[model samples]
Target chain A: MEKKVILDGNAVAASVKESLKERINLLAQEGITPCLATILVGDDPSSETYVRMKGNACEKLGIISKRIHLPKETTTEELLETITELNEDEKVHGILLQHPVPEQIDERKAFETIAIEKDVDGVTSLGYGQTAFGFGVYPSCTPAAILEIMDFYNIDASGKHAVVVGRSPILGKPVSALLLNRNATVTTCHSYTSNLEQFVKQADIVVAAVGKPNFIQGEWIKEGAVVLDAGYNKGNIGDADYESCAEKASAITPVPGGVGPVTISMLLKHTVISAESYMSKKSATL
Target chain B: MEKKVILDGNAVAASVKESLKERINLLAQEGITPCLATILVGDDPSSETYVRMKGNACEKLGIISKRIHLPKETTTEELLETITELNEDEKVHGILLQHPVPEQIDERKAFETIAIEKDVDGVTSLGYGQTAFGFGVYPSCTPAAILEIMDFYNIDASGKHAVVVGRSPILGKPVSALLLNRNATVTTCHSYTSNLEQFVKQADIVVAAVGKPNFIQGEWIKEGAVVLDAGYNKGNIGDADYESCAEKASAITPVPGGVGPVTISMLLKHTVISAESYMSKKSATL
Candidate 1:
């Protein structure tokens, strides 16, 4: 049996952190601190923990983090007001609204309120569009981090057939666009996709972003394909059946340590870029 | 002998125009004339003819068309100013910048200047992004027209394998997003794509947007597939090997009468939608 390669999300994320340090220092020296504000509506314990982990990551990386909690009953108008305030805040470089905002709130409408320059988490439609159109962009964090990991591993996507198994706006769709932009022949599959296994078998690169745990059967992945599992369900379950898929994959990401850590790292990375871009534009105008 | 089905772009466009007659009248009664502004940068005769044809279409549909000609030496700054002026104009419901602006001008920069609301031709990055994210959006005209044609033909995309050849931001990219939104398993291919024929043979629907004449071979198209030829090269040449592909295809769009006229019709449709939307927003505010 050939030895399979494991792509370490922690190691890759640490390296990205090292690269961002100098830029973070430069901003601090110029009396500009890159600030990211995260808004969480409703008290979902897991959402809170996720927000705290992100805040801790921000603290370690020297990026300022402001966490705001809203009541579960918060209305869309109130949330939009909060986003608008953050959009206008000169000190804030990025705005992230923790997803699954209480069922009452219109998450899309709230996302649209974030100014494009400050959409470091890349939740806004404009961010998605600009990235789709191949503009210099702050990409959605998880998908962008996947690209970063691939680049670090020297995985050139050009001419490769990449099959993305999900259509979540943040993960599957954006990842497909990024891959297509990099010259990968991309196939976007979802629940409605017939013969999902057939599509997976044909891909040189397979990105399993379908949220359902172990949804992608491991055997469907051909030998020597690069597998990226973006699903991190409760209890370490991922989109791909990791053990089975890894046997066939030349390289595959582990469930817990694969996509999560790198995703957090990209959030900070985009925030720093946003800070620099915004401050430069302000200075240029002055 | 099986009869081949040719999708008539002209008759469809006329039907679309006819359907809008009531809305056009309602807008007229409200004194809200839906207007489209066309910005031309240089004396490109082909471009002039296209603009004139679109203008004539608007005249037939009761939509106002403003054609603004700028000298070849028009600076990006000057064009931006013109776009800004149009963005603020109460009367201009849509703005279309005929593509391929002079070499000296930055076309993307000029496109970003169009307000998202008035981007009926959907050239703005924001417009593209909004459409990709499944928002109520004014989509890029040509791709939207293709969707309209498909809808008119009752060609449901659900569970279909759609191969989009070409990655041009305008046609191939946007159309891929639209198809995905309709639940089609979409494969986006381009010049860098290898095994193009293999992919095409597996597709239920094939969209040829590659600029090269007869770029997609006829035999690659599977029997009973729907073909959309978006390529309109000079001398009436299109991307697909039309005769051969049509023989195998259940339905196919012809070069001159297939995708072109419907594209113009969609521009007017989007404009009317934008005009009505803007007026409603205005009324809601009042």
Candidate 2:
């Protein structure tokens, strides 16, 4: 009759962080501290806050955060050179370049410069291809975190129809691949989609990443379907009309605290996992 | 009005080959003889024949196909080293490892060892990722060939519902991305799909790559939907029930002379294109 449950991404993120204490200590014992090198090109306020939060999260988990802040006038070649240095650093397990780099610098080129081994953010196409092919080292954080939340709720995606709105290389597309890997029938929609409502109504699970405030009408969701809102539009609004979706959805994720916290936590998780992978690969070669 | 157009892939392949003569000659003048290194790991008769056909096609197109055959007992490392050799070779512009490497060989590992620049077959994750992200230097041959056929027929896919069955990295997956890039709203279905008929019935375009003969029935297709059957099962059958589908489809491709010729032709086209790209990149760096 009413919304059955609200997915609390903050609580989930905390629980994940709580479980990482022992693993972090183990890495320290092996004389290999997990380090994440973050490159922030410009000082956009919101991006600054996001990077700060990531750094704080790493601090809490006993992981080292290496911050490299560059000026707005940074060029593509310089950023590429910095990324190359990080890629070749044995101590650096993961590389994160704050998105929306300066206008002069090519963002896609910068994303690709992050080596496959240290691509914890899953920004590279090679990383995505690995995910699609079913054996990726680390999937892009947001989508992978969404899956974690879904698993916490014991939602089995096998044979379910999942409609994912948005097709950004990092978010919508990779999430669709994750759902498919779980044997869910996945449909990808974009701005050009026709009769989007029809597809949404037939879906058993819905993931909205359209980046438009309240773009998905709550009434369009099939009753009792599981819904995930990955949108963070202006004024903290999400893609789904939360009030409307909460009335019908069996489970719904609230904006702000819903996806952001889980995603950031997954970023930390991926960094630690990347550190482990590097250790194993190094040991194998030795 | 039964099967108004057969969508003859063989004729299109021939036309494409004819158009490449001048370009091939122009490249020859630059001292760049478009070379494709074909690596066949075992002596499977069918695979050998396939490789031979590809070589014969290369000869006709003024492209040199260097054939490399290894014993069935070859290890994964051996194959990887061979691929690395081709990757670094200045004269080798493209690398094609015929599928179904011996059971002992790690086919995917060998595929990934291919350099992104030399991955003309588009078999690597990097290539697939590039395709999924909208602009790829080289698309996987079969799916890219399908796009060529659709263009030959002047089919505009913008804002259309394109339902693709199968999720193999090469055919179904990459084609779905290509259609999406062309502005088609794409839905990918697989063995785990539920209510596949519903999606197929509403599709403006349908591409079947499930690898099973007559896997898709005729009546499920919406009247006059654009259909592409990429299946080539035993007895030369396709995924679509061609006899039944031809009665209702607007355009359809036949099994033997349809996809096979176009796909093979595209392989040669890719090798030549790769050679040009190599020359340009080399010149740029020099």
Chain B TM-score, one value per candidate, order as shown: 0.97, 0.96
Candidate 1, residues B38-143: lDDT per residue as tens digits? 9989999998899888888888889998989999999999999999999999989999998899989999999989998888888887888878888847889889
Range of the 10 consecutive residues with the lowest summed lDDT in candidate 1 chain A: A1-10
The 10-residue segment of model 2 chain B with minimum total lDDT is B1-10
Best candidate (score: lDDT):
1
Pairs that clash in candidate 1 = A129-B129
Find the candidate with the highest TM-score and give its number: 1
Q: Which residue pairs clash in candidate 2?
A: none
Off by over 4 Å in 2: A1-3, B1-3
Residue-level lDDT of model 2, residues B1-286, one tens digit each, is 5537898999989988987887799898888899989999889998998899998999888899899999999999999999998988999988999999999888999999999888889999999999999768889988988899999989889889999999898998899889988988888999988889998998889999999999888898999898899998888899999988877789999988888899988888888888888778878999
lDDT of 2 by residue, A166-236 (tens): 99998999999899889988888899988999989988899999999999998899999988999988899
Docking class of 1: high
| Model 1: per-residue Cα lDDT over A77-149, one tens digit each | 9999999999999999999999989998989999989998889998888889889888847899999989988
- Candidate of highest DockQ: 1
Model 2's i-RMS, to one decimal, reads 0.8
